[model samples]
Target: MTADPSSGAAHDALAGSLKRTEIQRAPLSVAGREIVQVRTEIPPGVESGWHIHPGEEVGYIVAGTVEMRIAGRPTLLLQAGDGFLIPPRVPHNARDLGPGVGEMLSTYLVEVGQPLAAFTEPPDSASR
Candidate 1:
């Protein structure tokens, strides 16, 4: 699916932090599902705010270093050649921890008509 630049103010707000380039999108054999591939670039010290996907996301770190924080799980320190998976609706965030830009390739199997990702309040925010 193509991202509409003028989609909404929320999307524009999120885009300011992380750069996401859609690589390909195709319909999946499963009814009501589609696969979307994206290349994301994160600047040093930037964190992808906590968010949830409509389905599952399979991602591979392509460059630099990153820390993956999935709610309820131990944080993972990843580098190029490392891969991770996020189950449907699980809140997670990726932070660039690098001397240079960090890049990741993510492929998602998601339900059609829903945004690929939806940002949410941090899981631990309630305690703050």
Candidate 2:
């Protein structure tokens, strides 16, 4: 398929947004917790580096293949309808498994004393 000239720019914006996404952050047992939801399309050869989350991340592979690595374990392949959870502070990285488009939806549980700032850009040193 022909790629739109703006596709790259749009993906970059999406990645930037993901890097900065946040929910309501508070101390222990605080009130008014907020959850953050982000959905973005990913092109081939793109990936998120090794990182950790302050709150729990529950996600499903709605379309295409997503390869994920939890902490130091081997990368696990996930397909449509497959779901996984990443607990707080557990390092993980993910990427598309093929040279095709894919999408995933993620919801972070930021309720009741969740730390929003824990969601951040991964370090540059991690690789696929």
Candidate 3:
């Protein structure tokens, strides 16, 4: 497929919106294990709140640009074709940094019954 000239770039745009679609979900052979695949679209300036997944998450940027922040790690600027992994319970968040909507496909390996994500208090608020 021919990539759009602007697919991997970020654009200056106002805060927009996010949409998610579940591609698939299935139970794994390992007891209590499950896998989930999802597609997400984030409009300019939209961001997921600081949160954690109950399991490991791996994803690939499909289009546009995303800014990701993971605890203790340098912020990442991901573009189309970029891929990433977030370990279970690691706090992180992603924002669309685009002139167009940012898109991604994510797969998660998790324990059955665990919620997909859990929002958390900011680091400074933890001590309160």
What is the C-alpha lDDT profile of model 2 across 9-78, one tens digit per residue?
2222235433322222224344554455545455665666556655778887777788887864556798
Q: Would you list the C-alpha lDDT of every candidate in the order shown?
A: 0.85, 0.58, 0.76
Span of 10 residues, lowest total lDDT, candidate 1? 5-14
Superposed model 2: Cα runs more than 4 Å off? 1-14, 17-32, 72-74, 111-128
- Any idea what lDDT model 1 has? 0.85
**Local accuracy of candidate 3 as per-residue lDDT tens digits, 36-89:** 787778889888777787789999999999998887677889999999999998
Model 1 error, position 1 (Å): 6.5
Count backbone overlaps in model 1: 0
Worst 10 residues of 2 by lDDT: 1-10
Clashing pairs in 1: none
**Per-candidate TM-score against the hidden true structure:** 0.88, 0.62, 0.81
Ranking by lDDT: 1, 3, 2
lDDT (tens digit, per residue) of candidate 1 on 14-128: 5778888877789999999999888889999999988889899999999999999988888899999999999999988899998999999999999998888878877873222
Which numbered prediction scores highest in TM-score against the true structure?
A: 1
- Tell me, what's the RMSD of every candidate? 3.6, 8.0, 9.0
Error of 3 at 112 (Å): 0.6
